[model samples]
Target: MRDHGIGHIVGTILDAPENASVVKELKEHAREAGFKAGYNECLSHVNPFYKSKFTDERSGFHGVDTKALYAAAVDTYNNLSISAIDDIEEFLEAENYVDRLRLLYDYPEEEETASGSKEDAGTSGTKED
Candidate 1:
């Protein structure tokens, strides 16, 4: 776990924050997915014969150990990106699974309003019943 990895981890967490129990869950999953490859590639370049990846085959880790990785990733994410995560979460909901297609048709707004003007957002008067 290093200070530098948090930004990438946080980006993964924010991508699907709803599924994540905590920021760490997201980080661990992301790291397990491809970060390990990238991490190992860099490490190998530094010491091609000696350095190993973050996970070792002797440990029998076919994939990320979610429980263990969660601890490390969360600790790193919290320490480095708690404030950034907080702000990001504030701007968007963790899980936003709206029925977009249904809503798009059900509540079809004027073209101008849909294009998003703040003034129009207040006066989208299609529902004037």
Candidate 2:
């Protein structure tokens, strides 16, 4: 399974300032939700592949351009926060403040498939038992 640790998730959240506010608000909401908002930079080492995919650029690499990548990351973070906050609001019965904090804790799946589906394509005439 892919490493979806907090640092990896939060680093994606912090990749863009537009999404940084979401991270900030999520931290605040987490504090109010009785969870500590811990910070860690360890994700840099957890998934070397993810790090290379998002931040590094090498010739012959077909990853998204940096600007587009950053924008996508922000959009992804916003969507997830939206979903999380919706769940939180339902749990807390705080419909009134849902909109305010919704964007904070939500994070939706990214629009583009990570690294595409090529990695999963099966070899012709190959079968798995």
Candidate 3:
């Protein structure tokens, strides 16, 4: 688990007009970090700005156990700051809801590390991205 709420913070910062500079820096950092896709994927899953693909009736994520994920997101949002943008990939690691699902389903880990972090080495093939 990487902290607990980077993902929620990312969405919050990305939406705040006062954080434009911070968002700019965070976007550049995300690209350099190799977890851009994962961040985008995370946003697509939980960010209201992104309208969350997972919330779509046609999305495969539909009917999945997102209660915990949403609750965590809400809790995270309640206590976020601009400074939390660092180590954004940890957002995915925040709740591990998706990771847990993948693990439970026996999804094989891809050799390529999405975030170039040892912790995320097994996070490929999530398909949600």
Candidate 4:
């Protein structure tokens, strides 16, 4: 049996931010921005961010779970940072929140080694120059 439970994993994520506060803040900002759907999408990223802390090798028999979570995280990031937020002003307002969420989720720099260091991380996703 696994020593760690889902509750423990969830706790680690929620520990950084009171879960209710996160929801309240995101809902208020996203709802006012006329992107309630984005709120749901943004909030959904937390699961994978936390879960990605566990690697496939560490996951034992449930390695697929780790892979799935990581994939979900990447997909969510791409969606939000690329497609979800369209307007520059609206996207700018929400990007900070999403960035915090990514940090809180413990985004894996090691896993993103192909990007060559976190500082070098670049994407044409949502921001406009």
Instruction: Point to the candidate with the largest lDDT.
Output: 3
Overall lDDT per candidate, in order of appearance: 0.46, 0.41, 0.47, 0.41
Superposed model 3: Cα runs more than 4 Å off = 1-59, 84-129
RMSD of every prediction: 14.8, 23.6, 23.0, 23.5
User: How well does candidate 1 match the true structure in TM-score terms?
Assistant: 0.23
lDDT of 3 by residue, 74-103 (tens): 455555565434434443455655565344
Model 2 per-residue lDDT tens digits across residues 9-111: 3554456565566666655444433311111123344457564433323323224243444455555656755433344446445434323332444434323
- Where model 4 places Cα greater than 4 Å from the true spot, the runs are 1-4, 15-19, 35-129
lDDT of 4 by residue, 6-120 (tens): 3434565445344444455555444434443344355566558784543223322222333344445445434443222233235356535434434434444423356454342
Predicted candidate 1 versus true structure: per-residue lDDT over 22-57, tens digit per residue: 655656566665555565566567765565534344
- Shift in Å, residue 44, candidate 4: 32
TM-score per prediction, in order, is 0.23, 0.23, 0.20, 0.21
